[model samples]
Structures are given as C-alpha cells and as structure tokens.
Target: MPASTPVAHSKTAALARVLDAIPKGYCRYTQGNVSASKAESLARKFHLRYGIGCTPAQRVTRRKRGMANALLVMYWPEGCQQVEWLMLATDGQGMDGEKLLDIADKPGMAWLGYELVRRPDRGRTAWTWRRPASEMAEHYALIAEFGNKHHTNSLGSLLQRLANQPGFHGVREQSKRLFEEARRRGHAGDLPHLFYVQKVSHGEWLRLG
Candidate 1:
C-alpha cells in the first residue's frame, strides 16, 4: 500500500486487524508453508501501517530457537540508518515475562524489547517494557516526560536527552555504552547533540556545545 494512503483506522487498529486475520495455530510453525507465508504477509502489512519494517529475512519463530512458541521480529528504523529489533508476541497477546527474559539472555541479538498488545475494545495498543517496572521507574519517568514534550518515546530520544544532561554523568556513561553496543550490533545511528558540564557559583548545569 502507498505510505500516503489514509488508513481507515488508527495504526493500532491496523495492527489488530492484521493479527486478528492470522489463522488459528499459524504461529505454531507446524502449520508449514501456509503459516510462514501468512506470517510474512501480515508482517508486511504491519510494516506499512506502522513504518516498522518486517520482512521474511527478519522472521524468526520458536522453532528456530527450539522453543515451543512463536515470535514476531519487528524493526524500528532510526535516523542514522540504525534499526532496532522488537520481538513481539505472534498471538496478539502480551508475551510471557519468563519467555522474554529467556530470549534476552540468549547470546545472539540485543533487543530493546516490549510486550505490545492490541486492545480492540479500547481501539488502541498497550505497551509494556520487558524489563521490570520498578527497576526502571526513573528511566520510565524520563522517557515519559520526553515523550510528553516532544511527542516521541523512542530510545534514541531519551538517550539524546541524557547525553545533554551534565548532571547525569552516570546516565551519560550508560548512554555511551548503549551507543557502543548498538554500533557493535550494527545499529549505529546519528550522533546526538553534545553537551558539557558547566560550573557556576550556585551549582553545575549542562551546557550544549
């Protein structure tokens, strides 16, 4: 479909429609070529509506990992040609916590994972980070604040903000580590604006450079 085409419903509705259209047991992979083909089709539909690319090359199922479930690999494109993976549940339901952790623990791909569930009744989608909420309360707050201000909740945006806050030396360091890891994983993005710590009589603050 043309990217400019007006979707009949919101993006979330489109996602729900795509997922709901999948045949029962299609996620099992045991359904054979029919299932695989349907998955690819649905993935493409999702990509068109959401601007997140999903192709046959990026598809991975539980069978591939020796697990007894299904997974959807969705990629979010970044400004600097970087793409991050989000392993979503194939059944339209939220993913299991243990299952998500198991996938994260594996040595292959590093993903910024989340459980996205389509709420047909609510006419939207709900998102929950795979990590524990308590462990990331502060980061979540920061992300929410940034999203509220800039209308985006992308990790890159949060990292950019952190990189500009000199008072957050630890966060800045963590951002560097994430950037390096992203680069190592072939997910390099445009460099965020640089900032420096400036000293004053009252206290220290961030000074954009």
Candidate 2:
C-alpha cells in the first residue's frame, strides 16, 4: 500500500498488510485506539515476531495503564524515516519518562493539570481535552485541538486524553514539530506511535489467534 493511502479499512487489517510488506521477523506494538486484538491480529497476519510476556495487558507500560488506550511498536534501525509511520502504530511516551522529561517537559505526560475526584476508598487524577496553545499546535492539529486547559495523570488519561490521535486533544504539536525537526537534524528523540481504545472493535488484539 502507498504511504499516502488513507487506510480507510480496519486499522488492524491495514497494519497487518503493511507489516507483511516489510521484512520478516519485524516487531510491533499498539496502544490507545489500537487495541490488543488489533496488535495480535496484525502480528499473526504477518507472522512476525512478538513479545513473549503479558506482564501488562496489551504490553502497555504499567505506569500508563488506564491512562492510555493502547500502544504499538515496530523497531527498525536508524536512518529509516518512512518506517517511522509503521512504528507509530505502537506509540510510547518515551520508555524513559524521566529522560523524555529531560528532553521535552512540556505537558501531557509531564505536568498534567486537572483535578481529583474520589473518596478515601479509591481515587485518581482526572483531565479533559483542551484547545491547546501555539506552543502545542502542530502535527496534532491533524487530529484534535486542546481547549487551553487540561488535567490528569491517570493511565487512561494519558492514553485517552494525552496520546496523539484523530479528534484527540492536549498534545503540544509544536513540541511534535520540534521532535520531527530534531529527527530531521539527526536527533530523533523518541519513537512516535498511534493510540486507540478497545471499544472500537479491535477483536482479541493481544493474542496471536
């Protein structure tokens, strides 16, 4: 399939086809909108290698659970920008959150601005999408725009509210632009991936059925 193709079909199917088109034994992951079923389905579709454990449901980071929908990973050697898109199918907020912060501590994953709602029994941070400021309006504009205010540090919030996706909010696109520029200047800071939820019918995404 062409890079510019809209991929209007199921993301899992489309990603499977794309993976098959690549070299054998390639690794991949999915997050947010890209459910576990999608990841497993696509992995099996291409017969590529996948992880060996299930410590965290869907292989998503434990810190980002509930905060994210899902994550996909496709690792390739450096100097392959086109592969960036394929790898994007499984995004990670810098495997090293502290390191990512050392690099870009803008918002979203870092300084989340929201509220806390719950009794002593149990409670968690909460954040909603915002319009976003110029400091945070670039590649994300293609998906959604923050409302100028956001708050949440929960895993679900990170994935559903923070990670990049169509109609999503709270991403600093300018930071993304900078991320891209860094990559262009031989400074690819971190791997960028797509995110999605499980309700979209990913279908047994975590297993190689």
What TM-score would each prediction reach against the true structure?
0.22, 0.22
- In TM-score terms, candidate 2 sits at 0.22
Q: What overall lDDT, based on C-alpha atoms, would model 2 receive against the true structure?
A: 0.30
Reference-based lDDT, each prediction: 0.34, 0.30
Q: How close to the true structure is residue 178 of candidate 2, measured as C-alpha lDDT? A: 37
The worst-scoring run of ten residues by lDDT in candidate 2 lies at 110-119
- RMSD of every prediction: 19.0, 17.7
lDDT of 2 by residue, 1-209 (tens): 11112221343333333323223222223222234335334444432332222234444553364221222333222233222213222223333221112111233321112111112223642222333354244433323322122212222233333334432222233334534533443431333453432333222223433
Best by lDDT: 1
Reference-based lDDT, residue 4, model 1: 19
Misplaced by over 4 Å in model 2 are: 1-105, 109-124, 128-131, 135-198, 201-209
Q: Against the hidden true structure, what lDDT does model 1 obtain?
A: 0.34
Q: Give candidate 1's total backbone clashes.
A: 0
